[model samples]
Target: MARSYQDVLAGARERIPEIQVSELAELLESEDAPLVIDVREQDEWDEGHIPDARHVPRGFLESRIAGIADELDAPIVINCAGGARSLLAGVSLDEMGFRNVKSLAGGFSRWKQDGHDYTVPSTLTPDQRARYSRHVRIPEVGEEGQLKLLDSKVLLIGAGGLGSPSAYYLAAAGVGTIGLVDDDVVDASNLQRQIIHSNDRVGALKAESARQTIEGLNPDVSVKVHPFRVDQTNVLELMNEYDLVVDGADNFPTRYLLNDAALMTRTPLVHASILRFEGHASVFHPYEGPCYRCLFPEPPPPDMAPACGEAGVLGVLCGVMGSIQANEAIKMLLGMGDTLAGRLLIYDALSMSFNELRIRRDPECPACSDGAKLEFRDYEAWCAGERGHAEAPVSA
Candidate 1:
């Protein structure tokens, strides 16, 4: 005989340990807060859930648990829209060898009904309120959303053509912290497209020059400069320090490294590349969307690709694509409209037209798949003969 939903839920509750919503609220207030996981669908989560709750929908819990939590012995609390689903999830976690797991009794509804506080963005200060008044006026980026942008951190990989425009716009938009990584010195030739650098700063370090420019544009922004090339040794740690990474690197080696590093840390990467009058931009969010490796599993043959210095690029192309990158980053920080997460936007200045193509995550992606493990490798060695094909270093 088939059992009803109630019978199934009753059986699940019998095997799982549960904590009252009121008690959980008290525990949350204490210093030792348990790791709370919300097993609701995205829509349900968006409506309202616990503050700082790790969202692992019931359907994807089994696949995502290990990535989210390494210490199986830590106190873990699971919840859903109602008490029933949470009990079921608790049972599953217990079976998965997770220790000290508890289901939240009555779930979020009960917590809300019991007068327990829910999550909301903190209030902005008077100065911040005034500074972001225009952004606040926009419905999508109201006071709350503007606060999110102010709290966001974005790291840029290069201070050349792409990074120049992107950094300027992001700083102007009030991104709280901007990290720049570039080891080259500005040259006279860079003035054509690398607008952030001035002719007087020809020998100045790219990262430092960009920092000074951004600081001048917006004193509220904090610019951190990594005055060295990003390699396997420092790439992972550097990327971890920021909330998001913008790939404005001019070469395939750095691009590939950033892609792999972003996947390993599960950080979102906003990537763009330009050559001649054509430019390409996309967002790579590991697991949730396709990664750079998913699109280009391997770099092109050394002789097949030409660098910007060799093939030449239109200065305006950088502005167009880099500005789009900034647009995506702002939208991501504000949690606003759709991003180019799973789509590639291609721009052609000659035709004066834009086109888009969808990108899909590779189940066997060498860098991002759950079963795959990728470590940092010598990108320079891999791109040995392709040095000329890399994005050209900008001259001031």
Candidate 2:
């Protein structure tokens, strides 16, 4: 099969990527940033480097990139004691066709002489002042975002692996309210990844047990237990009251149902799922952002993926994925930072790697496209061919 443009580029960059410092700094200052990469080795970085710059030595760059969270394909500025190595790095990256990259002028020496700010261990410290203390320092996530995360409400549509860590982080982040919708009872099998609920909570209402666990983590958080399975009947009502919705469902029916309902209400849906060692996550909204239907256009079959109940998942992978989902919610609520609106984040937990794909709004999408009717329609029956699946082929 012929590779699409994205697949070809994804293949090329998967092998090699480039860097640009000045452009990196500007990007950090732009809507895309907060990134300043230090390509020097540990000892070289110790001499001097930009504050908060991620240090990934040139020698280890190829081998170590897979472990860096949210680091894939982002613009990076390389620096060394001098600009020599960074120039080579930049050129190499450019050869690999990395878009929007450059090298810092004069490396650390110039940044220091110019008084641009350098720190030790490349670690951001709290005493550095709240404004520049890591998250707040980025234009993307400012004080406004920190506060939004504190007061935001999010509902997780499941209580198994995905919901486990999604709920945990939401509570820990001080989210004002977290609604758990699940009709299943906790079971010993869940303890492997559903860390919030313990062995004792088994046989208990999964929703209620999830709530109790959140209360234990931070009593300030208000957790509402909705012991009913969310479907077309009440998904809108349950999700309407929350600021954000995290779809951790394991089946296509509920996922499509949630997508249709969220589209009708103009609510943002953080969609995610785990199968074996792979997972995909993204934010979908019909009114303001790319709807889930835009990405899939059509839902997968009911048995496309055997339920997680049958196919096992990597326990820790759920935590990693769910934490990222919570992070997106925080970024969205505070109205700061880049939420995954037009991007799809795919992860391979076994190798600890991730890839971000461009998500374009389908101008012909039935939900949010320019000519879209934006009506509440039955997704299951639609996906089930009730109205005849191929009747209206997605108008590209």
Candidate 3:
């Protein structure tokens, strides 16, 4: 039967029950709050909408509703600028076998006129939309996840080999702030693996050189250069400032110090160590998974664990490990995917092989165990065998 728009809206209203704006507002605050779906256009939604409302848009309602609402019997409330569109949307949901569906009688306009609380969403500008178009297209890391990345702050313990690739990729991915802690200056020899530095920048402070490189790559990222070594005195203060730490220190003292500080500050640590023809990577989420101390109760003897400078490392190995660290850091920030929290990843370039080892948190861990007292110790002395040691774990 041919019908006018009014006739169709009248039929929808007859089929779908409508709840008044005042009633809906009270329902939102209740324990049994319904899933609020805003069927407004993009511009309308950006201006303002009900707090905790999920935007499905009237056009995509039928197609995308299932993903947002898992169960057919779940309570749902549809809303739009006025009441007509919400009524129509409720009819569609009803036809789709949704048992509990209601329309907001006066929609967002009435809700706002009634002095109800609303939220104006933060939207990306045109430049940001185009800049992170690739990331926005991803289902797991859409606009919401990208915004989280843009608001995050990460700390890198070195501006050398591993820090170079991690910082570069993180900046390109739109990480808002990156803090580089390095007292060393760039040297010509570091160019082979430390891609963030150039031959012309030799003798420049590593943190400053890396900051310049990151700024050039992505103007959206702010780089904070800390031209000082991280020690017990300043490690906690530094860790407390960032959301997560990427451990790229090549020396045992710095690595151990970062591990302890990370635990004390309850910061997630993305750790990677590159040696000749090999690399190791893992994430240490405080109290959630095994920590660095849990993996290695004691630092290996100086003779057994040689620095890359003393033992030489493959130039490409740093890129692989550092990139992994960045990946882990992003996952942690987004709170998505299974991170390497309880696992150790070992990569061997010579054999072209990858291996994983499960890491269980030590109940008696000196740093992360239940009721364990976390305090900074003389990491340099401990690593150099000046302090008492225990049998180190066998795996990397």
Candidate 4:
């Protein structure tokens, strides 16, 4: 004789022990809260689910559960759309030798009906709270701003001098996602200023070197490595993924490429450069102020401006310049304080003084001006002196 669907569910219910929604709500407030796993699909989870619930859909539960939490004896609670699926999940986990697993009674439906709140997890650990205590104590960057830092994605264009200190502080501040682009490897000569890369990382790709240092500083950060140099072809697409762009590139070619890409994408760009004792920092917001081009209009003659390697930079100057860039980036993400938009901040370490210059947007600017079309250019060739002018053709 064939069994009815209700009979199968009845059998599952007997094998699965459950905890009431009310009881679980109370348990969540305790120190020994069980790991809550949502077994719903992506769409359902996105709609609304319990706060801090680790999502592992039923289909992939068995394969991923151990990776999510290894202690079979640790208390675990599984939930779904309603009570039925959760019961089935409990039975499966029970058979898998999990010692303390329970289904959510009445599931999400009853929990919602009871006026329990639903939220995505903030994912902050107690250690993080203590680690970022200084930032939390600040009136401007209190707990809320700290949370924003943990949610922001910042793209850094290089891992050289400027990128080195900038990436370190940004990671320390708990910027959740940091994307790094650098094709060069860590060279022994870089030790003087590229503080993020150590002697052990010599010959390793700069992006990976930076990753190791940042991961060591704060495990909460996620570092995405682009192990290749930025060019016109992929610059725009790369900038699109980040909330903002930080130009730490050492050369004019990359600087121009990043500037155009940021303007075209309408993304905020924190621009900074360091040379010897003098360093410059500014924010180029596409519409709010002048883009990088509005100030220089074109790269200075190659003879006039040489790479830091050739010209020699004061090692500590990178720290000052990069820290300022990080400060500007944090301000932009938190939307606090007046930014460097339409103004340039120049720092001279020799004199230990700072100067500000006012810049205005050029209505006929090729990058951000109205009706100005963005185009891809051979930046390497342009920077290599193959082209006398800085402008590139417009893309169709």
Candidate 5:
């Protein structure tokens, strides 16, 4: 027998309980507030809705409810533009084995008429929505996370091997502001690994070349070019200006300088180093995890550690490691999945293997110890073994 629309509504009203707007408002402010789900369309939701309400359109409610609701017995309040839709939504929840579901009496319309608080959420433009459609579809990096990425700023300490891929992917992901620090001009040799630079721009400053590439990749990202080497004099200021730093410096002095400055500024650092067929990457989250100095108490003897130029790095190794650095940086920006904060990732392309080593905060680390005083030092001399292992006297 076919049931009339009025008869269907009557059956739903009998199965679901309705809570008044004032009662729902009071419950929202209590210690045991129920999860408020707004079953309105996208346009309706964008206009305004109850503060802290989760939007699940009526069409998607049945399919997406499980993802939003944790338990069958958990209290849930369903609401829509008017009372009828919410009552129907509650009936569906009841049929789906949800034990504690209630419809909002008179729904959002009544709540608004009663002068309750509401929120107007920020939405993405059509261009951004299309550009980052893949990212927006991810549950971990939905529109909210995409917006967060757009508001984030990242600083790449070098525009060479590691910085090239890191900057490229970060820009592609719509990291709002990217600061490129490099004083060197692109050399013919750099073309092997520095993909951000082109043959036509061989003699151009690396920072400028990277900026051009990044800007060309995404108009949403603002590229700030700092055509100077990062030294003790300006490291802290530069670190302070950005939310996070991607350490692509090829030398130990710059690495140590960045480590100490990062501690002082309490900034997160995404670190990666590549040489030959091997690469190592880690995340130094200020005092939260082990820092660069914590892993390497002192720079290795000059003869033991060599730069990629001298040792000759595989071009693709930079892409692998730099892409890892960018991944770690984006995870940090979005406050998502566990980053490599307390672990070192070693990638050996020659062996076709990867290894991980746990890293812990050093209690007596010179740069990040509990009581150690941090100050800029003669990093170049220190890394050169001209100074002793103890922290050198503060440089002027």
Candidate 6:
């Protein structure tokens, strides 16, 4: 028998890692799924095994890994009949500089006895061609941006009207990593503006379809679907991994949560709102510039403003606003130009007009200011009242 990886190369223990079946399952159950690697000898895999696992015989793992280079960031779990081969595989993968790699402790036989759901790969129809042709041809957004789009990772909070456009452009832009967080299923009524999804996607989980649409439009981008709405507890952890947070929400509660979480993480926030024929956008980064609270200390009363569903919105307005939002994101990644920093840009589709307004930082802004250390308060309660908050200092 080929020695256990730990015994094969005692020094390899310093390089390779071993993981348990439960741990691997938990990782897959989390926001991200780890790539399950079967490094058992080919003869071992011909017997009963684990589900959704890939075959990479021990002898060939290192050389063949080039084919899956893009998936490096994904968690990797290697397994064999028992646990020995997996440790060896991990050593091989790690010596090659794989960022996150580990071996299944109990291996496939254990998972089989325990009963885990899994399926073999199946073929699917190719997405329609027109989905991404236009974006690919534009000179400014050439293949480079498309590749960058494929490489980028973003998390969108909703699948309603606002999320509709954000999803469309982010998919079109080819961001490498795209995450969708929404609990609702699609509905026929959303077709009027939620263009990223369609009548067919109706009744399906919004995040799931959102991922499908992206793959259909451009398979180059990776999709992570989260079938739940974000709350205060999960907001920080979710948004921390992203470069920017685009708030296209209709409710003040989620918006406030995004703002507060972004401030704590020192993240750049892009706020976009659409109602009737009008749209507004601004960039808020408390650590680098003034924040949303620095400009508007409190949310308007619940009844003061009508939502898009009630107030009405131009369908195409989403395409216009969302494209601009993506443009801002691109600018952020390239470090090339000025952003909507400290200023809000408003657009009126009916009049085809645009206005840029400079928003001032209030020295008394609570969220971004050093006025006083306030305990993190409940979002809805804080936004309901018109209490003023102070600003700390405003940078460019």
TM-score of each: 0.67, 0.62, 0.87, 0.69, 0.92, 0.60
Ranking by lDDT: 5, 3, 4, 1, 2, 6
Candidate 2 minimal-lDDT segment of 10 residues: 122-131
* Decoy 3 TM-score against native: 0.87
Where does the lowest 10-residue lDDT sum fall in candidate 1?
387-396
lDDT for each residue of candidate 6 in 1-396, tens digit (9 for 90 to 100): 777645675665567677767777777778777887777764565554566566667887887677544556567888888777777778778778887887776777677666775443231122412444565345344333444555566777776677777777776666768777888888887788888788877899988887888788766677788787777667778888887776767777677768777888777877888888999988886667778878776777778777787888888888788777777876675454699988899999989999999986667877777773533556666456534431222111
State the lDDT of candidate 3 residue by residue for 1-396, as single tens digits. Answer: 899999999999999999999888888889999999999987899899999998877997898786678899999999999988999999999999998999998899999999999999888787888999898766567677898999999999999999999999999999999999999999899999999999889999999999999999999999999999998678888889999999999899898878888887899999999899999999998888999999998788799999999999999999999999999999989999999999999999999999999999999998788877777677766788866442231111
Q: Model 3 off-target regions past 4 Å?
A: 1-4, 7-17, 59-67, 87-101, 349-354, 388-396
Tens-place lDDT digits, model 5, residues 135-174: 9766567677898999999999999999999999999999
Error of 5 at 14 (Å): 3.7
Q: Report the number of the highest-lDDT candidate.
A: 5
Candidate 5 global TM-score: 0.92
lDDT of 2 by residue, 196-236 (tens): 89988889998999888888877657888899887656877
Candidate 1: clashing pairs of residues = 187-395, 187-396, 190-395, 191-396, 250-391
lDDT of 4 by residue, 1-396 (tens): 998878888988888788999999999989989999889875677577898777778887786677566898999999998988888888888889998998998888888899999975443466876999888656467555788999999999999999999999999999999999999999999999999999988999999999999999999899999999887778888989999998999889888878888877989999999888999999999888999888877677689898788889999999999999999999999999999999999999999999999999999887778877777676767767766453566352
Candidate with top TM-score is: 5
* Candidate 1 segments whose C-alpha is farther than 4 A from its true place: 1-121, 385-396
* TM-score of candidate 4 versus the correct structure, residues matched by position: 0.69
Q: Which window of 10 residues has the lowest lDDT sum in candidate 3?
A: 387-396
lDDT of each: 0.86, 0.72, 0.90, 0.87, 0.91, 0.71
- Candidate 5, lDDT over the whole model: 0.91
Error in Å for residue 250 of model 1: 0.8
